[model samples]
Target: MRKLIVTEFISVDGIAEVERLPGVTWNDEMQRFKEDELADSGAMLLGRTTYEIFAGSWPKETGDFADRFNALPKYVASTSLKALDWKPAELLKAHCRKRSGN
Candidate 1:
């Protein structure tokens, strides 16, 4: 069985949506942690917002983080997206449910 680990970033006030938070950046420790975590994961599961954010930016960026992010297989849960053009990406239908322990 495979383990499903959900990783997220939230503000100190418990706000999960931080796309507009200014001066917010991942420190060295956080970067290292993220790199290590991604290294261990074979696939990435993302919501539509996050998937779009990454899909728009990571493709044009160059670095270890970008390389790892673009290289990993991604499964995105979205109801409105017509297509996922990001290479190695799959679009999950609205009725689909993410499962673990398979």
Candidate 2:
């Protein structure tokens, strides 16, 4: 079975807010995990908020995360982000494959 590992950027207080440099704690772990987690995935999933942030920053930066992030098939769950320029990123308006399951 595959997995839909939901990752988010949070503060030490469990506040789900975006931080610039301080939130780099899980960078290495996330990069390593995503590198392999996305390999067997048929698609990627991101909420509108997360998608916008991710779309605007990642794949544009230079690093290992960029390589891994840009490589996977991407899907954004959004009603607003109608136009995505990422080579393989797509906006999902309905249900998508659930990590090889329903």
TM-score of structure candidate 2:
0.65
List, residue by residue over 13-87, the lDDT tens digit for candidate 2: 777756564546666777667677666566677777777777778867887656766777777776556687765
Looking at model 1, residue 38 earns an lDDT score of: 85
Pairs of residues at least 3 apart in sequence or in different chains that clash in candidate 2: none
Q: Which stretches of candidate 2 lie over 4 Å from their true place?
A: 20-42, 94-102
Error of 1 at 10 (Å): 0.7
lDDT of 2 at 22: 50
| Best-fitting candidate, scored by lDDT | 1
lDDT of 1 by residue, 22-92 (tens): 46785999878988888889998888888988888779989887887799899888877889977798888
Instruction: For model 1, state the Cα shift of residue 76 in Å.
Output: 1.1
Best prediction by TM-score: 1
